[model samples]
Target: MVDAAITPPSDVDTLAAGGEHCSAHEATGHHGYAGDAQALQNRLRRIEGQVRGIQRLIDEDTYCIDVLTQVSAVKSALDRVAMLLLEDHLSHCVVGAAEAAATSGDATEVNEKVREAAVAIERLVKS
Candidate 1:
């Protein structure tokens, strides 16, 4: 398990300053929809198949290193999916919330979301 208490930078401008948004979708209309959702699903399906293959390997008494290698691959695949989702959240939801908070003079909501994102990223990194 990963630690979930890390606080993110409180300054919204600093938080929004530098990162490049790398999604393929156009920025205007595709706010909430993740463009890579289908690809992420496909990757997860492949990972599931890989897991089944690991089970078969175990049933066949396959070597330990081989099983470990496949497990690592599955972990990497899951990490990729997580990263995609995180990017989507940062670009869309987090940014929008921060904008709303700034306009409404309610920075607490933005800070909370930033903390949440920080914790999520920390977990992903630890995993």
Candidate 2:
């Protein structure tokens, strides 16, 4: 259960110095998963249920191996979600940046986008 005293950050709270940003949605205000936001939410809801199930298993004194197996399932589900987001980011943000750069005769945005993707990929791999 979440602590009532602990407030989660709002979108404005999470903003950097520049401005507020929605996850997977940058300056253009386009979410990479805009077309499938509901689907994504559903997947996340399922994951949440899985987590609750894990908690119940522990409460019931489930076998160590069984608990670990559920934990692994959760991890894999999360990884799949991450991969989907990454794919959408590549298809939307990176491609959009490249297209815009081509017209503006500037590679800065494209380079930045690529670098961001590389960093995200690295982090995912490390995890």
Candidate 3:
């Protein structure tokens, strides 16, 4: 049985999932939401439906290839959302941290921020 709950990763969720709540924002500057949150939500909602549809295909005993097609679509949709969030984070959090480190002459803060970004990218790549 497919578990039906689908939660999109928000800024808080993503940050915490990676580690801390993006405390390095001070290095980059006061980072905040950098994209259209509403649009992201809408896209996630659609992806959630796609997930459900794949489940339905399985329940209906649909052809294997057809179900796989839906699975592929769902994966692609989720990847898009992840990319959007990643782009937003880079623009806001990462950039802000870099600026903050520069302004404060605290190179370690920049290192920390880069490490965080690297971890995030690693997670994305692994998945």
Q: Give per-model TM-scores.
A: 0.70, 0.78, 0.74
Q: CA shift at 76, candidate 3, in angstroms?
A: 0.7
lDDT digits (tens) for residues 1-127 of candidate 3:
2222223333423444543445444444444453467888899899989888888888999999999988888889888888887777777666665666566665554454555566677777888
lDDT of 2 by residue, 1-127 (tens): 2111322223322323333233236556766878888988999999999999999999999999999999999999999999998898788877776676666666665555566666667668878
- Go through the candidates in order and give each one's C-alpha lDDT: 0.67, 0.71, 0.66
Worst lDDT window (10 residues) for model 1? Answer: 17-26
Instruction: Please name the candidate that would achieve the greatest TM-score relative to the true structure.
Output: 2
* Candidate 1 per-residue C-alpha lDDT over 4-118 given as tens digits, one digit per residue, 9 for 90 to 100: 2336645434444323332222335554435676887799899999999999999999999999999998898888888887787777766765666556666655555566577
Q: Pick the candidate with the highest lDDT.
A: 2
What overall lDDT, based on C-alpha atoms, would model 3 receive against the true structure? 0.66
Candidate 1, which segments miss by more than 4 Å at Cα? 1-33
Candidate 3 Cα deviation (angstroms), residue 78: 0.7
Measured with C-alpha atoms, the lDDT of residue 84 in candidate 2 is 93
